[model samples]
Structures are given as C-alpha cells and as structure tokens.
Target chain A: EAGVVQSPRYKIIEKKQPVAFWCNPISGHNTLYWYLQNLGQGPELLIRYENEEAVDDSQLPKDRFSAERLKGVDSTLKIQPAELGDSAVYLCASSRTGIKEQFFGPGTRLTVL
Target chain B: AQSVTQLDSHVSVSEGTPVLLRCNYSSSYSPSLFWYVQHPNKGLQLLLKYTSAATLVKGINGFEAEFKKSETSFHLTKPSAHMSDAAEYFCVVSPSSGNTGKLIFGQGTTLQVKP
Candidate 1:
C-alpha cells in the first residue's frame, strides 16, 4: 500500500510571503493530521481532520495559519505572511480511523528566508 | 493533559553494541504508547506499540520496547546496533480518553552509531 503523499517536498519563502503545503492521504483513511517539526525536535500536532470536519485544531495558529480538508480525502495547510521562526518541516499523516496507526508523508521542508 | 519525555537528546554507541533510548510518560488512566523512527530526510515509521495488549512488544527491524506501568516508562532497545540504526527515535503517547484522537510526541532522541 502506498503511504501518505505530499507535494512540494521543499519550499522557500520570504518572511512576509504566503506559503501553502498539500497532502493526499491513503485510500479509505478517515483521519488526517498536520504537524510541525522544528530542528532537533519531534512533530507537534497542528490540526486534525475527521472526514470533512476538523475535530481538533486548538494547536493551530489561528492568527497566521489556516488548514482545510475539503471532501475529506486531501488537505492543505497554509501560512500567511510567514515569519522566519516558521522555518521547519511540516508533516502530513493519515490513518484508517481515529484508533489506527498513522502513516506519515516525507514532509515539506519550509525555509523562511 | 498527557505528555511524553525522552530522557536523552542524543545517544552514541559503537556498532555491534547494545542500544537503549529511554522514555517516560505521564497519562491519566490507561494509555497507548508507541515508538517511531525517522531517518534523515525521511518520514516517520512505526517501530512498536503498547496498547495494554502485551507488556513486551516486538517491532520491525528487530526493535522492541517494554512497557513498565509501575515505572511509567517505555524504553526502546536493540540487542546490537547497526549503522542503519543511526536515526532519530521518538516516544509517542495517545490518551485513552474517549474517542478523542491525538498522538503526543516526546522530544526526539538522536541516535549515532560509530564503527
């Protein structure tokens, strides 16, 4: 089975520019997640999607970051007016259900210059 | 609130030597635990998991982690280290509270293997 798929494996943007990351999860998966990982650190959950509904997104930065899982199969995470501190790896993961194991994508490495 | 802690930020060992990565967790009631490995420039892979099923859980690539409830610890260990074992290891926790789905990750521990 194919693992989670993400586009634009690497991205470079200016401090005030807008950046978006895309994710396509495995088939029949009902749960999708977005996570941020800084250098030398583990991934921290940013948002979670159960079908087309966002059940948990308290960790997401409401001020500058926004995410959506349209149709419940794919997702997009966007950061507007990016900051240098936003430089990190953004990982997308999915699972068959809320209780199953998650499979992660290769992650998009965002470098805010 | 639940959290996980990886005791070591970095661990160095010689090839063919034993490898150990310490992890401890704090959770209310029963919890599900996991160990994942991430190679450089790669994504995370499930190593093993403890869901109150087995105290001693074996995982892919000859990796294993023991869940100690009394000590609230789950440490990853391997009999012998290989060069390929050099990577980042993360201890993960999932609360058993209802159907609320989330995985809390500990600060990753980098593993370095020397010949």
Candidate 2:
C-alpha cells in the first residue's frame, strides 16, 4: 500500500511571494490533514478534511493561508504574501476514517527568504 | 479540546538501555492517544496508539505504550535502545469530535542514542 504522497520536497521562496504545496493521500482514505512543524517543535494541525469538506481549520492563518481538498483525494495548501516566519515543514497525512491511524508523506520544507 | 505534553525536551541513552518517553494528555471526553516518530527530513510515523480498546498497546518498531487513565498518561517505552531510535518523538491526542481525528501534538522530545 502506497502511503501519503507530497510534492516539492523542498521549497525556497522570497518573502511576500506566494507559495503552494500539494498532497495526494492514500487510496480509499477519507480523512486528510495538513500540519505545520516548526524547527525543534512538534507538528501543529492547520486543517483537516473529510472527503472534500474542510471540517476543521481554525489554526490556519486565514489572512494568508488557504487550503482546498477538491475531488476528496488530493489537497493543496497556499500561502500568499508569505513572511519569513512562515518557513516550516508542511506535512500532509491521511487515514481511512476519522481518528484512525494516519500515514504521512515526505513533507515540503519551505524556506522563506 | 484536546492537548498533550511531552515531559522531556531531550533524552539520551546508550545502546541496550531501557527507553522511556513521558507524555501527559488532557481531554474532556475519551480521546485517542498516539506516539509518533520523525527522523530528520522525514514525516511522522506511527509508533503506537492507544484507543479505548486496550490500555497496553504495542506498535511497530518494537515500541509500546501504556495508557493510564488515572494518570492521563501514555508513555512510550522499549526494552532496549538502538542508535536508529534517535529521532524526534511526539505525543498526540485527538478528540472524539470537533478536532475529531485531528491530532494535537506535544512540543516534541528528541531522543539520542549512542552505541
């Protein structure tokens, strides 16, 4: 079984620039999640998706961060006019259903210069 | 709301030594607890999980966690440490609803092992 898959293992962007990250969850998984991991810290949940519906996204910075899980199989997280503090590893994970064990993908390490 | 706390920021152990990582959680309802490991540049991997099913849960990589309802703790342990076990470990909790299925992670504990 293929685990979750993410693109752009690493990314470098200038401050105030817009950046996007993509994720393709495991087959038949109905729950998808996006998390941000700062250096030396554990991951923090940014958003969660049940199929195409975003059920929880309170932690996401609404002013600059946006995410979509269209088609219910893949997801995209976008950050507009990014800041230096936005630099962190963007991790994506998926599970069979709510609260079940999740499989993660190689995260995208974003470096905002 | 659900939250977790990793007791140690870092732990060092020699090979063959017992491994222990402490974790405490808070949740109003019965929450699911989990332990995950992350090697540098890699994503989080499930080491073990403790649902309401059993207090003693074993997971991959020769790891195990005991859920103590009285203490509200789920600490990961191994009989012996290996150099490969050096990584960042996180304790996580998920609410039965709301953040349902969404994990709230601790600050993380770095495990260092020496041969």
Candidate 3:
C-alpha cells in the first residue's frame, strides 16, 4: 500500500508571502495529522482530522495558518504572510481508526526568508 | 499534560558496538509510547512502540526498547550498530485519555556511527 504522500517536496518563499502544502493519506485510513519539525527538533502536531472533520487543531497558529481536509481523502495547509520563523519541515501522517500507529510521508521543507 | 524527554541530544558509537538512547515520559495514566527514526532529508519512520503490552519491543534495523513503567523510561538499544543507523531518533507519547492518536514528541537524539 502507498504511504502518505505530500506535494511540493520543497518550498522557498519570501517573508510576507503565501504558501500552501498538500497531502494525500493512505487508502482506507480515517485519521490524518499534520506536524511541524524545526531543525534539531521532533515533529509537533499542528492539526488532526478524522475523515473531513478537524478534531484537534489547538496547536495551529490560526492567525496566519489554515488547513482543510476536503472529501476526507486529501488535505491542504496554507500559510499567509509567512514569517521567517515559519521555516520548517511540514509532515503528514495517517492511521486507521482506533489504531495508535501512524504512517508518515516525506515532508515538505519550507523555507521562509 | 503528557510530555516526553530524550535524555541525550547526541550519541556516538562504533559500527559494531552497542547502542543506547534514553527517554523518559510523564503521563496521567498508562500511555502508548513510540520510537521513530529520521534520516537526513527523510520522513519519520516507526522504530517500535509500547502500549501496555510486553515490556521489551523489537523493531526494524535490529533496534529494540524496553518499557519500564516503574522507572517511567523507554530506552532504545541495539546489540550492534550499523552505519545506516546514523540518524535522528524521537521519543513520543500518546495519552490514554483518548484514542485520537495525537502525540507529544521529545527533542530527539542524533546518533552517529563511526566506522
């Protein structure tokens, strides 16, 4: 089975610009998550989705970031007026319902200059 | 709140020597724990996990970890290290309060294998 997939493996944008990343979860999976990994740090959760509903998004920076999982299959995360500190690796993961194990995708490396 | 701590920021060992990466956690109740590996420019990969099952869990690439509830520790180890084992490893914890699978991750440890 194919693992979670993310698009724009790498992105570079200037500060105050807008950027967006896409993700496609594994087939038959019901849970999806987005994480941010700064250099030298572990991945931190940004948002989580069960089907098309966002169940947990307490960590997301709502003022400049927004995410949506349309059709319960694919997802998109957008950041407007991106700041320098927003540069990090954005990871996507998926899991079956009630399961604790998650499969991850090659992240999008975002560079905000 | 649940949290995880990786004791070391970096660990270096010979290619044929044993490997150990320490981790500790804090949770209100029993928790599900995991160890994941990330090579340079690569995505995170599951190494092993502990969810109130056996204390000792074996994972890919000859890696293993023992969950010690008494000590609140889960340390990853390998009998013999390989050059490919050089990478960053993260310790994670999922709260038992819910099955949402949301995780808290540690700062991570970088492993270096010398030839």
Predicted candidate 2 versus true structure: per-residue lDDT over B51-113, tens digit per residue: 789899999878999999999999999999999999999998977654477778899999999
TM-score of chain B taken alone, every candidate: 0.98, 0.96, 0.98
Model 2: lDDT of residue B112:
95
Classified by CAPRI criteria, candidate 3 counts as: high
Error of 2 at A22 (Å): 0.6
Cα misplacement distance, residue B51 of candidate 3 (Å): 1.0
Instruction: Give the per-residue lDDT digits (tens) of candidate 2, residues A47-70.
Output: 989999998899999999999988
Q: B27, model 2: CA deviation in Å?
A: 1.5
True contacts kept of 1: 0.80
C-alpha lDDT of candidate 2 relative to the true structure: 0.91
- Which segments of candidate 1 are over 4 A away from where they belong? none
DockQ of each: 0.80, 0.75, 0.90
User: Ten consecutive residues with minimal summed lDDT in candidate 1 chain A?
Assistant: A95-104
| Tens-digit lDDT string for candidate 3 (B8-110) | 9999999999999999999999999999999998889999999898999999989999999999999999999999999999999998777878888999999
lDDT of 1 by residue, B1-115 (tens): 8999999999999999999999999998799999999999899999999999989999999899999999999999999999999999999999987866789999999999999
Question: Whole-model Cα lDDT per candidate?
Answer: 0.94, 0.91, 0.95
